[model samples]
Target: MCRWAADLGDAIFLEDVIAAPSHSLIAQSSHAREAKSPTNADGFGVAWYGDRPEPGLYRDILPAWSDSNLRSLGRQIKSGLFLAHVRASTGGATSRLNCHPFTSGRWSFMHNGQIGGFEKIRRRLENALSDDLFDQLEGATDSELLFRLMIGEGLSSDPYGAVSRVTSRVIEASRVAGIEPSLKLTAAFSDGEALHAVRYATDDHAPTLYTAAFAKRAGRCVVSEPFDRDGRIWREIPQSSFVTMTRDGTSIRPFAPATTRWALAS
Candidate 1:
């Protein structure tokens, strides 16, 4: 698994979210407190939306703790919405192209989870993608593949529904391959406007996810873990739920892929 953060609201420098906190994304690169492993040194990436329809992206194959470029960018770049991720390779090769916050025309996505038995079901999932989306794939990681799968299922117009379908399909594929605990995910994405996130798993255990609203700070953010130990600064997003955030506020609702699957079947 990996660690990530997403922020939306008043414009602010990226450093405020990625590097300045008590347990910032940069610090998590080498000493993540919540993930299964303490070190997520595979790679890292950041995507931020400004005035442009498409977001600006910066990624490197270096460990985030040792990357001077990452620090420099964090301190200099600012945005109203952004996402940063520190990778801990589940199975994919460690490379810049494989970094998180994968982007398309106007959408950016990042995930902290794994597609169980990915190698066994990889071809099935890839084959389900539309030619255009499949062709757009630039990395070999399941995370990227999952992004494209969402696109294929209509992410451009319906993120929640698209993701629900993708999750159901992933679980079905995993079952066919006889893999237990088909998936684990706590993922976030934005379309240069509002942000949508989900926390779900094939079984009862889901990766940790949380959202914080700083009444006196930059705004609201969703993260893999609370940046500070201050309980007042954050709230845990319940397992098997979908959260949506905009400048106005944040809301979360129950999420169940089985409901989505049943809908698809009928």
Candidate 2:
């Protein structure tokens, strides 16, 4: 299992949200209240978009709760949009490169699910990427490859379409290979402007996701789980849906890929 938090709106310190909340992300790194994997101690990464076109990235193999550099940086770095992730290794080795919030150019992504039978389908997915994206692939995780696939699929222009097309391809490949639970995903993607997210799974049990509105800061946070237990503080994102959160507000829609899968199942 993996966990992620994304903030969009006015520039604010990262710790204010990830560390200061009642049941903060740092607290969840060791004792997650919602995910199947309680402790996400494999690694962590943060991608914060500041003045540059590309976001500043910091990833380490240390757990989020124990990393001093992360806490120090979180207090200083402020961004209108930023993403932080804590990873729980599904099966692969724990390495810094495998951490979430993978970045390429201006886009940053964090994911909380996996490609079913990834070891079998990894090659097929890699073969589908262009030479440029293939070279840019640094980590050996399904999430990184998926991010590259999205970039190749034109994430800069059509984020929803790109994610749908690539995810459909992955699920089809898994099906062709006789892989059960073809794909499960709850991801956040941003290009320094608006934040876009999706939750879908071939198994109909996609990972949990929520949007916590911060009226005081006048921003929004999309999290894998609510920071606190308060029901009113968080609004859950329904299964098989697409969400986009901008400075103005957030909008939700049914995700076509999951809809297509469910339609076929019925």
Candidate 3:
């Protein structure tokens, strides 16, 4: 699994979350406290929205802790919304193309879990994407595919429902292939105006996720774990839940697959 941090708040330097905290994303790259694996050294990526229609992205195959360039860039860039990820590949080659914070137009996404038997279901998932979405894909990771699949399923109109439909498809496909449904997904994404995150799995063993609401600002942060050990500052998101953070505030609610058995059986 991987570790990631997403901040949707005041326009501050990216380094505040990516490298400044005592247990920042850069620190998690070397010694993660909550992931199944301790070292997420395969690569790292950061994305933040700016004045352009699309978000700016910086990704590399170097481990976050070892990359001085990342530290320098983090200190310089400022944005109201930023996402940073440290990867520990369960599948796919260790390349920049395989890094996190995958982007499409104004949307950026990052994931902290793996789909069970992704290799078996990769073709099925790819075939389900629209031609336009398929063309947008530049990497071979299931994480990126999930993002495009959500877009094909109407993410721009209904972000939460689109993700539910995509996860339902992954679960159903794994079952048909005789693979144990072990889809551990805790993902965060943004469409420039708002951020959406989900902590869910086929079973109860979802990867860890947390969120912190700023006391003074109308903003919230979604992260794999609290950057610091302040229980008062962060709330561990419940299993099988969804979160949305916007300029107004933050909201949390239960989440379930939207696809019905009739639809799957048909």
Q: State the local distance difference test value for candidate 3.
A: 0.89
Cα miss at 65, model 1 (Å)?
Answer: 0.8
lDDT string, candidate 3, 39-110, tens digits: 999999999998897999999999999999999999899999988899999989999999999998889999
Clash counts for the predictions, in order: 0, 0, 0
Native-to-model Cα distance after best TM-score fit, residue 41 in candidate 3, in Å: 0.3
The global C-alpha lDDT for each of the candidates, from Candidate 1 onward, is 0.88, 0.86, 0.89
* Candidate 1: pairs in clash: none
* Decoy 3 TM-score against native: 0.95
Better of 1 and 2 by lDDT: 1
Clashing pairs in 3: none
For candidate 2, the 10 contiguous residues with the lowest summed lDDT are 257-266
